[model samples]
Target: MSAATATPARTAPGATTLPVADPAATRRYAWQVLRAHRGGVAAAAVVLLAGAFAGLVPVWLVGRMVDAVASDAAPSRLWWSAAALVVALVGATALAAVARLLVARTFEHALADLRERTVHAALHAPAAHVDGAGTGDLVARVSGDVDVLRTTVSRVLPAVCGAGATILLTVGGLAGLDWRFAVAVLAAVPLQVWGVRTFGRRAGPVFRAERAAAAERTSRVLEAVAAADTIRALGTAETHVHGVEEVSHRAIDRTVAGMRVSLVLTHRLHAAELVALGAVLVAGYGLVGAGAVTVGAATTAALLVHRLFDPVGILLSQVDDLQRAQAALARVVGVLSVPAPAGADAGGAGAEGAGSPAGHATTVPDDRAAATVDVRGVSFAYDPDRPVLHDVDLRVEAGEVVALVGASGAGKSTLARLVTGTVTPTAGTVLVEGEPAGGPRASAAVAAVTQEVHVFAGTLADDLRLARPDADDARLRAALALVGADWVDDLPEGLRTAVGAGGLPLAPDRAQQVALARLALTDARVVVLDEATAEAGSDAARTLDAAARRVLAGRTALVVVHRLDQAARADRIVLLDAGRVVAAGTHDELLAGCEPYARLWSAWHRGRTS
Candidate 1:
């Protein structure tokens, strides 16, 4: 197992892991959430305090019954005390249930808001950052970390709050009976504090490591699963499997280490409880012997000290859980720290009616006629020392189909990404409708479909609605029909059939048809088809091309062509060689005037004929 396997995709060359919120930011956001539900918080606190007070009445009443037996008091008095103790226990139970409910109701509202904001931040995150971070990091935060925080808020948090209240009130009851008994209980504080401090210092880093290792394992697994076919084809399946195993082992080791630390803390807390109980017993015996207090008062003090056991244990045990919750909270909120794309609303609340859930909102109205693209002196580099495209310029007239042709690594897809606003140029400008590419205006006007299309897991209609949320079923069927997806009728429920991962799996060519259908539903005037037919088999290529043509009919299109025949059919072909446009013309003109084009055509013709 290599070190690289432990780090996974986040530490890949040129990749940057997404940011995590600092302690201060996490605390601030938590306070903001609590403040939003101040009414509920106040109500929960009052109910909990009342429950704690009621819980102590039983201990005091038991002490009174002991004194009555020693002094031979009236039987009626002992009976009344016993009756009151029963009533107090019942009252405590009812108040505790109500307090727990109030705490959950109050905090759940804040959790819902945080959940929404985290999702919005993820969807609107800058494309460049998301590309570098890998999907595993995002998936872990939204899924695993969110679940952890949700459990903490709904269950563990209320327990801690109620336990704390009980502990404080019980300690006060000891003081009211006799101040020396309260002082005796203070003997436990030193050991308890040491235990918490030691656990905090040791467990924080272990839990954090566990969370990170879990994310790394997820990344390795997803990478292997998504590229299963490619791994098998290249005979590198063993390597991927080993990578996943290494990350899994690391995660397991961290989890075990955290558990060991928690066990050590529990032992120390147990010792603290023993020491406090011994001190309280000695104090009660001394006060009763010297006549410093009555037998009833001493009995009350002893009972109060014993009652501290449950609440104190509960409070101390929750320390480990709180550490884990804190780490998870930082990761979930960290996504919100990533900046949204240029011209997007702060916190990813994009303008209303921005078609898709994550769509960038633009102030400019749609103008199909003005949708001409111009790339002037555009240069790009993923790394500063290695330039991919140098001083490349190209243009596409409104409603014209321009094909970008090049050998692999000649920057064909890179250039298409720049024109479609997936990436910004390192040196120059990419303009659509006279405004900068990747800005609000350009993003609103442009839509893109690549060979790597995703069919979301849902009813077919829900997946289609992502592009045009308000679109009716008739419009969805029309778009699907236009793209030649006649297979929908064969499904058991037509448009209501579930699709995508774990659902009915569609062939690659059929999935591309769904992509084209979505593109058709958008009002975008400019469309980019980057190797959209590259994954289609020879038998399905013609069908996909026809679908691509219909989708691009009235839109200005920039196609990254893989098949030479597709380039030949374009209105104009721009051939890039070694990051430069070496030739641009009609297919026949290029063959007549450019030797490179003639050679490429001859080679392609030979491959087909052979």
Candidate 2:
């Protein structure tokens, strides 16, 4: 909620993250994202099956030619066999190409749809979760993870499938040549199983750790960039640089560990394949020497077994890619699973406590239009160990302006966030007109203007339209004028003037005025201003303050006041200290009854007089 960006702590070594607790469940959830293309998937599978069987024709032709040569067959017979082999190879390559193309086209469509769904889920996720994860983590999921998945599907996936098909057809060829030769290859199966299982166990956690580290590194860099100005003014660039370096080292360390695992896996797989090939040769030679099969037949059996090794080798090479995709899939699935806050799109929270006990928060009536608020027994903490707001109960009657005056970290902003339903309280409830705040229509019922008044990258009209899409140019101008921003009319394009990043430059106060104009356009009854004018210099702050007062005249507003002069005009003032309301009443009432309030007022008044 703070405008200043937060610099996350350096990620520790061996740190692993998988938001979803169960990998199997996560996979099931991920499948739903791709399920729309079941027809395409089926078509690809059919093509793959046809292509694999067609490719086996060359193997049969090779066996025929070998037998013909060993038997002193006619030259014409040998030439025919060679010609047939050429034709089979050409056809096989063409079929394989078609199969690969089909799979690629289908998966590309699925990936695009999945990405859109993931973006929707992230945007609708609870604000608490978004803030907790930080910008870097979310960006990695949508950008890095999605890109990796795309590469896996496009390249590694077809390779894996083709390898499996080749291996199966080769095994069948060996069985047809001589069943004894096939048994030699089968004997090495147990070793292969053991190696794969061992490698999978070692590799899974390392892959997860690697993904998490990359995200942490990205977050560190972004945090440093966002806080560059603060670091320069405070001379903490060296400190920030050190933090980024530590996280980078941790990420590299995880990657190095994964490489080591891959090496071990590769060596073990090769050893198993070599051992099986040696057994096949020995068995084939024995059968020939005993006259159980001809030399040509033995040669054919050995060739098929050796051919099996190439595809099996290729299959093993893709294990690392598959593991990476698996980890990425789990993360994407985890994020998509976060449930959207109830009534987030609607004006109020859904039926009060649908499954909640009868004594839970009551629902506000749909007809209520007053700007009243009820924060009952509300307590909150970003970190549970350190509470920010403690069992604070408060109310602002319709049309009343309550000033919340407090020192920094006194839970002023947190209280305001809860009131606007931008954040949920850890304990108790906050309601606007009896509807739980932060409901589907929460933003429409209780709007906020925080210190970070963003003018989104778009035309001035686009920014204003965010508050009320149906508002016209006349309405936009009227709103701007209400906030004392007459200079908007002086811009080259007026309401159409470009603002925000790379657009027309706006002085901080002017941008804030744009924010107020947007707020003026909202139909939200309750308005919470959390030091919204704190960005202005003293001279501008007075002008902004006057403008704010004019705009808030008939609205129910909860202003987190930084200036005592603002508090002087409040219908009532709630003084917060260490997260509790120590006193409440008018300026004279507080000065007479509250020592802290009197001292704060006296200190401020003397400073102003001097």
Give all candidate RMSDs, comma-separated: 4.6, 6.6
Candidate 2 overall lDDT versus native:
0.76
> What local lDDT score does residue 131 receive in model 2, on the 0 to 100 scale?
70
Tens-digit per-residue lDDT, 330-424, candidate 1: 88778887766564542211111122333334422333453799999989887566788999988899998999888889999888878766567
lDDT string, candidate 2, 102-158, tens digits: 888888887787688778777666666667677788888888888988998899887
State TM-scores per candidate. 0.90, 0.81
Clashes of 2: 7
Error of 1 at 65 (Å): 2.2
> What is the overall TM-score of model 2 with all chains considered together?
0.81
